[model samples]
Target: MVNERDPDAGTEHWLDLGPDPDLDSDPRHPGGWRWWSLLVAAMAVAALLLTQNQRATHPLPGTDPAGASVTRSASVAARPLPESHSPPRRTGSPLSGQSLSGMLFGASPAPTAVEPAGAQASAVSVTDLGHPLLAVPAGWELFGQGPGIVVRIELGRGRVTRTSVPEVGSASPIFFVVGHDRAIVHPMDSVPGYVVRDGKPATQLPPALDQAASALPGPDPWHLWAETETGTATALSLLTLDGRPAGVQVPIPKDATVQASDRAGNVLMFGIGGMYDLRQDGMHRITGGTLLAVGPTRWLTLECDESYRCDSVVIDRATGARQTVKASLDAYEQNAGAISPDGRTAALLQPNGIGASTVHLLDLSTGADRLTGVTTSSDQTLGGRTFVWSPDSRWLFVTNGAGRVLAIDRAGRAISLDVHVGAIDQLALRTTRR
Candidate 1:
């Protein structure tokens, strides 16, 4: 009802329901409504916050992150691994210097020493023996008792112990000649090839005896040019020991030299021109003039049945069997041959060539332990004169037709001597290998 103000300016309005009601007593006041609304809104906010916190604390199942590896907290399934492909090592081979590597390793192995059949005994000194028999290698080489004497096979010569060769032309006929070690002294074509045991002048043989002594094929093998009045000189017998038979007759061409007896008698003579091996009781025909003694074994004058270059054969002594093996000379040298004490190797003795005459040895599969030369000398005669090994394999006696008696100790060194008598036809060392 009052004067109307400008329309742009609105008039403030306030309504008063009651004059001064006690606000604490009032239940439905405008202020009350506002306070109730705030309380309800704050409670709603708190509830919503709690729900969000719970969700953030833990994510729901069935949801996994991308690119996660499958990690195993425990052991994995059994399967072949590349690292396990290695072979298990041998117990002995590991420490045998075979080049095996592992965290756990051991020591190297030792060699096997296979000695001959005799009961092991200490050897005797050469000085103890009276007669100035040829000296020899000591130890396992030769066993001595009354002295290392080459017992004379003939009763007449048996009493003659002194190795003193009579004056040249004195006519003390010498039926036996031996080369002590590599030294040769004998009465052959008679030129007096007498070398003493002390390197002194023993005596002299006739020119014929000298010629015969000098004619020996030095260190290579027994090469007797083959001359005979009967049967075309079929076989050349070896005279190893003083007491041995003249020698085993090695049949020529039709009957080859099958068994080579030692020059001194019986030392080592087996499997030469041998037949039948691998298969039992077998036999083969040996060519005539086909077999000849080379060195330890037989050197073939003829080729194998197949016409191959073969020189080695294994003989079954009981069955008289033979088996021919074709291989290089070195093969024989390393396996079959035993090196002499003086240092001359069987290999050096026999070089492969046309018309080569040589001597060789063939030990059973036991393998060869070669002897190394002590001194440096090329002359086979000066070094190893092919001292024959005794059948007993116990002694190594030296024979130089000149009469310097030498002995060999299979376990020690070879000794030199100044003594003599009839030239040694051949000599042998005793065998221990049974």
Candidate 2:
């Protein structure tokens, strides 16, 4: 039977039943299914808006889905990761800008090449010699007089050590033969000498050499020849560094003073008698010229004219070969020159003017002379300044009257020491043994 139904009365109940045909066709009210779909769509829209709001409030550390930078909120503080979980920071050369992840993968560049052994050493210049040890007289004691003091200067460290000599009085001339670890101060007087070792307190030499009238260095550093006189008889007594007699005694001319000796035991002496050469066989007088400097196979002799003008000649002891040293305009005294250890060169100081001398190098082979461009000044009280060549003959060490020491190389490069001692009486270098 067709019955009249109120539309609003059963609207709420329509959710439980299927669509009514009359209501669906009447078009007066929308279908219940249509109304329910509208409600579902509204709820989904609300949920999506809530999710979008949350993402904008707190963004991630990286870029967003739109490929734009997303900054995090200041309200939400970040926490540091644990050390074990953190990435390593890049440092040092060749990898300063590299990342840990890049290094772990195969993205790193090739490493730099290492230098070869001695390649860095080869970069050092030829003039660079590590600081050398130099010694100078500490006091103004007369050269031939009483006890002498020595001041050792470590050129690199600026350290100074003073060593005093004892027992040998000032009546004789004091001489020094310095070595790497030891230094001997022997006075020409008839008294005991002193030996200084490694900067320690000097000890007296052996009593056996107490009677030595004069002493000269032997062919080696470990030995020396002492001239001893016993009741009008003069002899050369060989003694070791420790003062023990070498058991070799050769009678020499009376009043003869030993000048220089070579490694072959040949001795050169000069005195009131004349210049004499003491060989293993016997003594022979050297005439016509005065011996200046002696080496292993060669010797220098000086001949002066009536006006005291001198000429130097190098003589070969083996074959008597002679070569005249190239003449210089400046006057050169006999005492102002020395022979190199290799016997191939002679270092001479030619007086340039008052209180000044110019250093010249004379080639023993070709007799050629050249200026070293080094000028030394003296106070004139010391008579003249002396210089010594390094055992290798690569350098010459000289001192000025002002107490400044200079090291001049073969190339004319000069370096001054940074110390001032005030009036150096004597100078010596503690050089390596050749």
Candidate 3:
């Protein structure tokens, strides 16, 4: 009835219910709803902050979804290096720039030095010792050291027992090959072939092999290839580790000198008849030259012209394929190339004719050669130097003319060992598996 005709008529209806309940309240002050809204906003902010802290404490398990690889990489960079069975790197003086690339004369700066051996440098360099001897590899021990022959026998736990050979002298340096537990000895003079184990005579070879001129490691870890002279001609005899004959005797020329025996026990010999394969009893009548290398799949021979400069011919034993490689010749000697164990790289010596010998590295696949600037401190002789390949084919151990032992890599980088193993007339590696 109050709002029947006027706009103020409905005002009393609303005003009558409230009755100015907050009339005593300040007009500038916020009400209860405003305070409640602020309290709710504070609680929400606290919940958001707690969720962020929890994520920081426990990250996701797998890859990061935030694309923060750079930050994660920093954490991994603090870890240690992995373990390997390689020789410790050396931190001695840097090498001189001595690598020559035929077309390029000057040497390049040497590679950065590796970490020092530190606490693990157990390889004692014994230059002061009077015994002219070589130590076994890292895990083996020198079983014996003597005037002409040194023997190394492996102990069970990667150790070795060293012993000396009797009746061997410097007058006739012993030529031998090491097997599993035994070594076959062939004295360059009148001594007969004998098998020695732990420094004692295990047994003697058959009468046919008594005149063995050379013995090579082969057939297996327990067999050796004895290049014997049968008075009338030369023959190849396969002998067991204990000196017993193991295979059919293959006959070679009387003057044939065995250069190398392949992994399959195939013998490569060179003589007045050129190159010959004793395994197949066939002659490689390519040219009269000296065999320089014998690889797993190939054999390298060098033929010289009137100037004494030589050409290297690599022949594939299986396929009879031949590849001729040309490089700077040393013009001084007959045999100097060494085919790596992996058959990928070759180390050649270009004797300077005076006394210093320049060494070079050749890539088998590309025929590219690099001068390693490695020099032997003596005149290049027919024998007395040593160039042996490491089991892994990554290193070459060379006994220079100056009598210093050096361990060189395929890149021609060298590390000199402070030891004198004497004039290595005949050298053999300790080939036992560790």
Q: Candidate 2 overall Cα lDDT vs. reference?
A: 0.56
Selected candidate, larger lDDT, 2 vs 3: 2
Between the candidate structures 1 and 2, which one is better when assessed by lDDT? 2
Q: Order candidates by lDDT, high to low.
A: 2, 3, 1
Give the per-residue lDDT of model 1 (tens digit) for 323-411: 55443343222212333332222222343344322333323232242332222111122112334444334334444344444544554
TM-score of each: 0.30, 0.54, 0.54
Expressed as tens digits, the lDDT of each residue in 83-188 for candidate 3 is 2211256443222232323113344556655543321111111112233233435443323223433434231233232222334443644555666666566655
Candidate 3 — which pairs collide? 142-162, 143-161, 143-162, 143-163, 144-162, 144-163
Model 2 vs. true fold: TM: 0.54
The number of the candidate with the highest lDDT is 2
Q: Distance from true position, residue 140, model 3, in Å?
A: 7.9
lDDT by residue (300-342, candidate 2, tens digit) is: 7776678998777777777877777765423565434666777
Question: Model 2 — which ten-residue stretch has the worst lDDT?
Answer: 119-128
Full ranking by TM-score: 2, 3, 1
